[model samples]
Target: MTRITSERHTDILNGYKSGGSRFNEWSREMLGDFTLLKWGWGALSMRWDIDDRFIMPDGVMFGGHIASVADHVAGLVAMTVLTDSKERFRTSRLETNYFRPLTAPVAMIEAKVTNASKTLIHVEADFVNGDEKLAVRINAVQVRRMTG
Candidate 1:
C-alpha cells in the first residue's frame, strides 16, 4: 500500500477542513476543539470535548454523539479513496457496538479506512476514554457511483 505523503495529504486535509461543517459545528458547540488536529486524503483523527451537552446524565458520552462521530469518520474515510471527485458515496449500512459504558468525561475517536474499491469502501473506528475502550464499530458500505 502506498503511504500518504505528509505534504500532499496536508493540502487535501486543508481543503477538507473547510467543508467539515457537521463535525466543526458539533465541536464548536459541544467539543470546543473545532480546530482539526489531523487529516489526510484518506484519513482523519479528531477530538471532541466531553461537555455537559455531550455527556449523558449518567456521566458518560452519549451514544448519539458517538454514533455521529463514527458516521462522520467512516464516511470521510471512504470518500478519500474515491476515483470520482464529482460524486459522493452514500452510506448503505452502519453499525456501532457499544462495548463498555463510556462513563468518562472525555472521549477520543480514531477512524481508519480498511478497504476501498471502485464500488465499495469499508471503514471502522474505536472510541476510547483514557485507557478504557468504549466502543468498536464498522459502518457504511459506501457505494461509489460507477462511471463508464
Candidate 2:
C-alpha cells in the first residue's frame, strides 16, 4: 500500500473537484446520463437518469444495473483517498441488498467511506428512488495496491 500524506490527499481531492463529471467512456456506456452532485474527502453523491434500457420486462430497474452503479460510485469515493496516481484499488467484496423495486426514472446514489486504512477501504452506498425511498443498499470493501 502507498502511504498517503495529508498534503497529497488534499491535492488529489482538489484535482477531483476541478475535474467535474469524472465519468469515463466505460462509465458512460454502462450507466448512461448521470450528474455528480457532490464530492468531498470521503464521500460522493450522484444523480442518474434511468432510462428504459435499464428497466426489466417487469417494469422495474434491473438489479444488476443498480449493483453496477453502486460499485462505480463506491470506487469513486475510495479514489478520493488515494495519494498517488500509481496507487489503485479493486472491489474485493461487494454486497447489495434491494429494499424495494425501483420503478422511477431517476435514482439518487450517495456513497461514503465508513473506514479507510493503508490496505483497505470500506464504503456504503444508498440507492434512493424518485419517491425518496430507499431502493437498494450496497456495502463494499476495496483493497488498495501500489503499482509501478
Candidate 3:
C-alpha cells in the first residue's frame, strides 16, 4: 500500500490544497476522508465527523482519535510548508492535553507551524467543536528526513 508517510511533499501539498476533494487520492484514503476546512502557507484546518467508532465507552470521543487528528493534520501543514524545500518530515514527538469532554459530533482542528529549522519543526493545534469549545490542545515536533 502507498502510505502518506512515504509520499513526496508535492503530492501531499496538492492533496491538501484540494481539501478532501481528491487532489491527492492517497491522502483521502489514508486519512479516512478528512474534510479540509482551510489552508494557508504554513497552516491548515481540517474536520472529521464523529462516529460511533470514535466514541469511547463513557460517551466521549477517544483521546487517541483526537491525537491522530492533530498529528495527521499538523503533519500535512508541515509538509505543505516545506514543499518548496524538497524536504520530508516525520513526527519526533507528539503531545495532547484534554481540556474538557468532546461531546460534539464533529471535530474541527486548526493547526499551524510554530517554528521551523533545517532539522526540526514545531507545530500546535486547537481541537474544537462547532461552537468553538476547546476539547484538546496538541503539540508536535517534526524532524526533517535527510535523504541521500
- Specify the highest-lDDT model's number: 2
lDDT of each residue in 59-85, candidate 3, tens digit only: 887777677767787687777567444
Off by over 4 Å in 1: 1-12, 15-23, 26-35, 132-134, 146-148
State in Å the error of residue 53, model 3.
1.0
Q: Residues 16-88, candidate 2: write the lDDT tens digits.
A: 4454434444566777566667777778888888888788988998888888888887888888777776778
* Winner of 1 and 3 under lDDT: 3
Cα deviation in Å at residue 69, candidate 3?
Answer: 2.1
Candidate 3 lDDT = 0.72
Instruction: Write down the worst ten-residue block by lDDT for model 3.
Output: 1-10
**How many residue pairs collide in each prediction?**
1, 0, 0
Q: Look at candidate 1 and give me any clashing residue pairs.
A: 31-49
Residues 77-132 of candidate 1 have per-residue lDDT tens digits of 66566544354677877898877766545566666777776677888767676665
Local error of candidate 1 at residue 116 (angstroms): 0.8
lDDT per model vs. reference: 0.62, 0.79, 0.72
